[model samples]
Target: MLFPIFLLASVAAAATGVIFKPGAWYDGLRKPGFTPPKWAFPVAWTIIYLLSAAAATRVAGLPGAGAALALWAAQIALNTLWTPVFFGARRMALGMAIITTLLVTVAAMTVSFWSLDRVAGAMLLPYLAWLCVASGLNWRIWRDNPAVPRPAA
Candidate 1:
């Protein structure tokens, strides 16, 4: 029921990454030695997204889940914003901002979900971990490509 819907929304958010792929612009930029391979982005994102959606679904029916669901919405909205800001517009700084917010919101959701359903909270553990790596990558990318100008709005 809600699981599929949540999953679909995650998939929709993920599509933005595919549509606004890193391409030559991303490839040309310097990345951290620890950056994961290009192919790993989609694969990792797919699993992360699905797990997050399931976590949301698991807690959606709980009595005080309104706040948790709201956090979920915030995280997803911020999640959707990152791909466009970072890749589509080539605005690493702005992308970093969005990703940072995403990291926090996801964390908030994680705690909220945990309070409601530990399983749901646990489901997002991987996403929280991944976002840590992603935030570092975003910061490093912005640092490495200092000369690359931010795209015009």
Candidate 2:
């Protein structure tokens, strides 16, 4: 029972990227230096999601899982929204702003989860680290490609 719940969380997170068709937009971009290989993202995210699910499961049994879950949901919504903002809408600058918000929220979630379950909080560390790198990348991408047109509404 617990395993499935965790899997659902993992699947939900995994599906967010796919729902936005991240690959197609990602492939179209002129990535900045140090952009990890295309393959790296899936692998990294898969591991990250699995760890997150584990953490979530741990937290689920605790008292604050409700709040933790709410925070997690909010972060995931922001996470999913970024792909379309950056890729679909071609608004890297705005996407950067959105991702920044996501990062802060995730950090809050991490702290909250830590209060409930230390291991769960620890699981989110890598996610926060990745977002830090991604935020920097988003800023650079927007800066370098200032001339790129924002996709029409």
lDDT scores in order = 0.91, 0.80
Error of 2 at 53 (Å): 1.3
lDDT of 2 by residue, 21-82 (tens): 65555566666887777788888888777887778778887774798888887887787688
CA lDDT for candidate 1: 0.91
What ranges in model 2 sit over 4 Å off? 22-30
* Candidate 2 to native Cα RMSD, angstroms: 2.2
Looking at model 1, the pairs that clash are none
| Local accuracy of candidate 1 as per-residue lDDT tens digits, 1-153 | 899989888988988977988888888998999999878888889889989999999998889999999999888889998998899988889999999999999999999999999999999999999999999999999999999975676
Which candidate number has the best lDDT? Answer: 1
lDDT of 2 at 56: 79
